[model samples]
Target: MKLLLRLATSLLLWIIMMVILVLIILLPRDMEVKRIGVKDHMSYHFTWSGYKENIQQYLADVKENKTLGTSVAHQPVEWELAHYGKRSIAILVPALIISFLIGILKGVFDYRRNRGLWKVLGEGTTWLGQSIPDFFIIIILELIISLTIHRMFPHLQLYGIEHWYNIFLPILFLSMYPAAVIANYTTQALKEEDDQDYIRTARAKGLPETIILWKHVLRNCWSKILIHFMPIILTLLSSMVIVEYMTLYRGMGTRLMEAIKIKDTIASTDTILPIETPTVIGFSLEFMIILLLAQWVNQVIKHFLIPVRKDEHT
Candidate 1:
């Protein structure tokens, strides 16, 4: 019931945020006109009706099996969607999997072993990973890999989806921050759990350290680690913009740049472009959906944690 309420509240907030963003994007702009007598006349006006009309038209186009709209490059929205979906899946899935595994392992290790060179190395690596900007990492990796590896295999593509290997750099760059954050949070949560009476009792029973660490400490800390890592979705999204743009991956971020360029061009020319509305709204919807999904995942993990923690106490 609590999970349901939280989900409901999150959905409501997401909707409200979307509505606000749409309103801001649809706000009026100043325009200049020339008349017979007046050399130059300036007017500022809202085009609510036009915005509504464009949305209706776009929906009708979809029903009739037409394009969503044209992008700045004159490509249909359908094309952009296909490419964006592909890149998003390719980058996000592998990154998430790798980050979660690495984080969990490092965290568990850090929790069980207090004094070691490995612990110091792990801590230092995560701190450095969290501190460095993703874009800089992407660039450095590209340069080093291209110079060394590309020379041996000139056929490998760095930026496009022509081959599966193209995604490696972006995924590696995107996963670093989240993995570091997860490891840090997991270690902290486990450290806090270390002083609890239950942990003390578990220790008193002379259980194997490995078993106690995994079955007791980690089980309790998992949900909190997930909660702390939820915001990594936003980080991934932001990183995608730079990663995709720099790599020319033709993903949603690249499409967004195209849309932004189109909007800017139209504004400068005093031309009201209907295509910009759908383009902007489409990206906004994608972001909101991702955020809601992250929240739902967090809530689900939290709900499961309640039962597990209760069992531990019992």
Candidate 2:
């Protein structure tokens, strides 16, 4: 009965998320850019047909605007759609998976013993990392690299590393912030779990520290950790915005920023709206899977260490 309820809840969440995704993708992109009435005077906008014609023509020109002097090539509407659809999926899906795995494992290790000092240190480190503005870090790093290269090797082209370094910088920046947060929260959770009576009782039973920490404490805490940390996996999509922009890497973030600043409706919408579909779907599925797996792991651990009737009563 509990398992059935869990499955139903999961289905409901998935349905709600899917509905939101569809609305975002289907909503009128031009609404954000359209001029509304001013305070002094009421203004009438163009008819829907006229607006469509203008926007269509603008989108057409966007593709051919080679002289715009941007780093990225201007893509046609279809190309932009296809490119971003694939890119969002390709980047976010695996990133969420890998980051979650790392976070869960690291969290297990950090929280196993539930040491208070370690928990405080972990939380403090994440808070520090999160407080630093992404752009500030980017600028500082960029200047340091550029200046260091200029002083050491005058012949080096702008920086010491090759162009590939630019690629790695954004990925590293995106990964680091989330990892810090994950480690911090995991540590705190573990520390809290260690204070529980069950953990103390396990130790009292002469269980080895390793088995008590991992087999008992970590297993019980998995559900709480999963619920609390689910959003961490999804946040990478937003983090990429700052990381990619600061590094001047040609990722979706750069393109999206340009689209918004220029008020290019199609470009902006294409980047933000449908592009998120795959990321949403993948993240949703992954989160659900993790929840189930965590719950299953929790149950298995509870079953072996203690009797079912005891667990139920507790």
lDDT of each: 0.73, 0.54
| Residue 258 error, candidate 1, Å | 1.4
How many clashes show up in model 1?
0
Cα lDDT for residue 54, model 1?
49
Superposed Cα deviation of residue 214, candidate 2 (Å): 2.9
**Model 1 lDDT tens row, 233-313:** 777787877877777677777776776563333334354443465576667677678878888887787787767766765
Model 1 RMSD in Å is 4.2
Report the alpha-carbon TM-score of model 1 versus the true structure.
Answer: 0.81
Q: After superposition, how far is residue 285 of candidate 2 from its true place, in Å?
A: 17
Q: Native-vs-model 1 lDDT?
A: 0.73
Off by over 4 Å in 1: 30-79, 112-116, 262-275
